[model samples]
Target: MKASDQTLPLQNGETLDILFRSHPRARRLKLRYDSVRRAAVVTLPPGVSEKSGLDFARRNSDWLQEQQKAFAGQEFLSPDNFISFLGHDHLILHQPDDAGRVRREDGRIIVGGPAGGFEVRLLNWLKKQARIRLEQAVEEKTGLLGVTCHKIRIGDPGSRWGSCSSRKTLSFSWRLIMTPATVFDYVVAHEVAHLREMNHSPAFWREVDRLVDHATISRRWLRQHGPQLMALQICGKSPAD
Candidate 1:
């Protein structure tokens, strides 16, 4: 546990991790679950006491545990299980063959490989797909913004869909490929805009809007469902039985 983090005891007897964040412009105490950190975040407005924040978290410990339970109950990546691909639910199907490639067929994701490596293969394929899409989007956006990206990387990041480094490298969550094309494109535009404006000032937001359409709708969708994307896990096989 970091020195800045605290622990809260849940009604279910689990010790929930709490990360306190102090924001200068925060209007009130807010609590949220951090899917990547597997902890609860308590945002403290400028004048709030740490003790008061802890008490607030205690008051909502049940809500925090509910989030933990929801993610814990998330199923693995296996046959017959549904997964979102390009903003659509696709059933996972296992093909009995070694070294067969993963492919989409008739709106389903077909995995052709040993059952033991099914999850690994499927995840790798998804990463590849994410990289391909991000690379294409980045190339297009950078050109429009008259900027150059140092590198492009795809991975599972906590609480952020995309980031642009000072070095000009761009990082994105592979799970974004599962979201709608507009959502994915908006994230790409967001990071690309950062290549020119490093802060979230009005200028940066203007650049984001200049790059993509339906910016408001995309932002709203992510705020509501980003956690659901992070909650995805490849647990023990739920292969077709």
Candidate 2:
């Protein structure tokens, strides 16, 4: 299920939903935040009932609330906060005196600019990276499929990541840049495949598989984490702020 589908109410009327699933090897009920997926997860042991797991969740509401708060505005790019780049977290460092352009070094995004406009600089840098990679992937995948993509446009759309127009123009979310290259490639391949077959028919899927191996893995990754990327505010002020 998508992250937006279900929500659990926490303190301050916040709803950062927790994911509950059963695990055969679990020895007991377990509740912890999945940093990679950015959600609270509860695991029920073989004999533990779902009711017990939920009660365990509610019993620890205080900790859960803290997690929710930490994750809420954590996506805002600022000094001392890490931002996603190439599917990895890069610490944001503002070197105001340097007066250099944005660059990467030692698992950090080094920004040499005034602190107030620091995030805006990083935002533009990330978008440029998105365009370069998306275009390259589209060109390669379309060539393999023996099709043509008229144009490629990159932007940040809240829900949809990528789309194919009837005119053969392809649009993709700049947020895809935050994910691993494999995930980015999967989205491009999916859209380029649409150039050959508009509908998501079996033939269309077959075309996608031909362009990208292990398509299922990439699809699952997106469904699990895409919403988080959508919720992540790159530039604008957070709703809570």
What does each candidate score in C-alpha RMSD? Answer: 4.7, 10.0
What RMSD does model 1 have?
A: 4.7
TM-score of 1: 0.80
Off by over 4 Å in 1: 8-15, 20-32, 42-70, 236-241
Q: Which residue pairs show backbone clashes in model 1?
A: 76-235
Model 1 C-alpha lDDT versus the unseen true structure: 0.83
lDDT (C-alpha, whole model) for all candidates: 0.83, 0.76
Tens-digit per-residue lDDT, 1-241, candidate 2: 2232334567777665667778765567888665335566778788886567667878888777765555454466667777778789888888998685888889998888677777677777778888999888888888898999888888764456899988999998888888888888888989999999987789999999998897899889876776567667645553221
lDDT, candidate 2, at 67? 56
Q: Which digits, one per residue and each the tens of the lDDT, describe model 1 over residues 103-146?
A: 98788999897777778778888888999999999999999989
Residue 65 deviation, candidate 1, in Å?
6.2
Model 2: ten consecutive residues of lowest lDDT: 232-241
Model 1 poorest 10 in a row by lDDT: 232-241
